[model samples]
Target: DAPVPSGAKGTYALTIEPLTAIPLYASRTLTSSDPSGFTVQTLPNDRGLVSVPSTSEDLSILQK
Candidate 1:
C-alpha cells in the first residue's frame, strides 16, 4: 500500500504501534481544533487568489 499525500481530505489507515515506535516528522504543528495529527494547513487562506504552499512530512524509525 502507498502512503497518501498530505493536505488530502479522507480516511487513512494509521498503524499507531509503528508510529509510536518510530519518529514521525510533521510539516507543521497540529492545531487544537484538530488533534488527530492529520489535518494540516498548507497555506494561509485570506483573499480569493491565494498561493498555498505544498508541504510534506516525513516518517523515520528511531531508536530508543
Candidate 2:
C-alpha cells in the first residue's frame, strides 16, 4: 500500500500489477465502502493505490 504524503488530502489512484501473467483479465477500480478517513483507488491510471487523509487511524485491507 502507498503511504499518504504529509499534508496530502484528496482522491488518488492506486497502481496494481500482476505477479504472473493471466489471460482474459479485466481491470476495474476498487473503492472503499466506508471511507471514513482513508480509501483505496484502483483504476488503470492508479492501480493498487490508496488515498489517505492528513489525520487518520490505523487501517486494514482485506482481499477476497
Candidate 3:
C-alpha cells in the first residue's frame, strides 16, 4: 500500500499480471469504482503497468 499525503495528491503504480504465460495485447483498459478518487493512467507498450492518481480525501478514510 502507498501513503497518501495529508491534504495532498499522489500517484501509485500498479503492475498487471497475466493469469498464464501467454502473450497478450498491449492495449488494455482499466476502471475504478470511484473514478473521482482514483484515476488510472495506462502506460505505453505491453509492460502491464498502470499509474493511479489518488486523492488525499479518498485515501484518508482508508486508514480509519
Candidate 4:
C-alpha cells in the first residue's frame, strides 16, 4: 500500500489479475426487488480488497 503525503491528493490504481483464465461459462445476474423500476447488477460485488491507511501514519503508536 502506498500513502499520499498528508494534506495532499493522490491518484492510485489497484488491479487484480487471475493466474487462471476466469471461466467465461460462469455468470450470474442480480436484480433489485423494487417494483418501481428496473435495476440490475450483472457482476458480483466481491472485488478482492484490503484495508489500508490513506495517509502516512504513526503506526508505532500501536506498540504503546
Candidate 5:
C-alpha cells in the first residue's frame, strides 16, 4: 500500500471490476408492526462523491 503524506500529491493506477449496483436494505425489515406497506426504509449517511473530469486530450498513445 502506498501512503501519501499530508499536502503531498501522487498518481496511482488500480484495476478492478467496476461496481454495477448495490442492493441496500435487502436483508432486514424496516418497521415495527404491520410492516407490509410501512416497511423499514432507512438511508445511510452520505459517504463520499466521485467524478471523472472531462478531458479533451487524445489518449490513443497510451493504448500500446
Candidate 6:
C-alpha cells in the first residue's frame, strides 16, 4: 500500500494470491486528504488473482 501526496495524484498496486478455492478480498481507508477529506475502498468486488505455472529453474526444483 502507498499514499499519495497532498494535492497530488498517484496510483497504487495491490496483489493477492489464495492457494485455496476460497475467495479473497481487500480493503483500504484514507483517513484524510490534503483538504481533510476521507475516502474508503473495499475489494470484495474489485480484487482478484490469477494462477501461473512455475517456470523458473529455482522454483521448479522446489516444486519437485
Give per-residue CA lDDT, model 1, range 1-64, as digits (tens). 3445558798843222223666543333344545544456333222234355897765553532
Error of 1 at 33 (Å): 20
Clashing residue pairs for model 4:
none
Over 16-61, each residue of candidate 4 has an lDDT whose tens digit, in order, gives 4456887433233333455644433334334567766688778898
Per-model TM-score versus the true fold: 0.16, 0.23, 0.24, 0.21, 0.19, 0.40
- Candidate 3 at residue 62, lDDT? 72
TM-score of 5: 0.19
Model 4 regions more than 4 Å off? 1-8, 23-64
* Model 6 local distance difference test score: 0.64
C-alpha RMSD by candidate, in order? 17.3, 13.7, 13.2, 12.6, 16.1, 8.0
lDDT, residue 15, model 1: 28
Off by over 4 Å in 3: 1-8, 25-42, 45-64
Count of clashing residue pairs in every prediction: 0, 8, 0, 0, 1, 0
Task: Rank the candidate models, highest TM-score first.
Answer: 6, 3, 2, 4, 5, 1
Give the distance in Å from residue 15's predicted Cα in candidate 5 to where it truly belongs: 23
Clashing pairs in 3: none
Ten contiguous residues with the weakest lDDT in model 4 = 23-32
Ranking by lDDT: 6, 3, 4, 2, 5, 1
Better of 2 and 4 by TM-score: 2
Model 6, 58: alpha-carbon shift in Å? 15
lDDT of 3: 0.51
* Every candidate's lDDT: 0.44, 0.47, 0.51, 0.48, 0.44, 0.64
lDDT of 5 by residue, 24-63 (tens): 3322233344454544433343444556678798889899
Which candidate model has the greater lDDT, 2 or 3?
A: 3
Best of the candidates, lDDT: 6
lDDT of 2 by residue, 1-64 (tens): 4445455579755344567776334444344446535544432333345555597565554432
Instruction: Write the residue-wise lDDT of candidate 3 on 1-64 in tens digits.
Output: 2334345556644466669898644333444555545444435443445566885557767789
Candidate 6 ranges with C-alpha deviation above 4 Å: 1-9, 33-39, 44-64
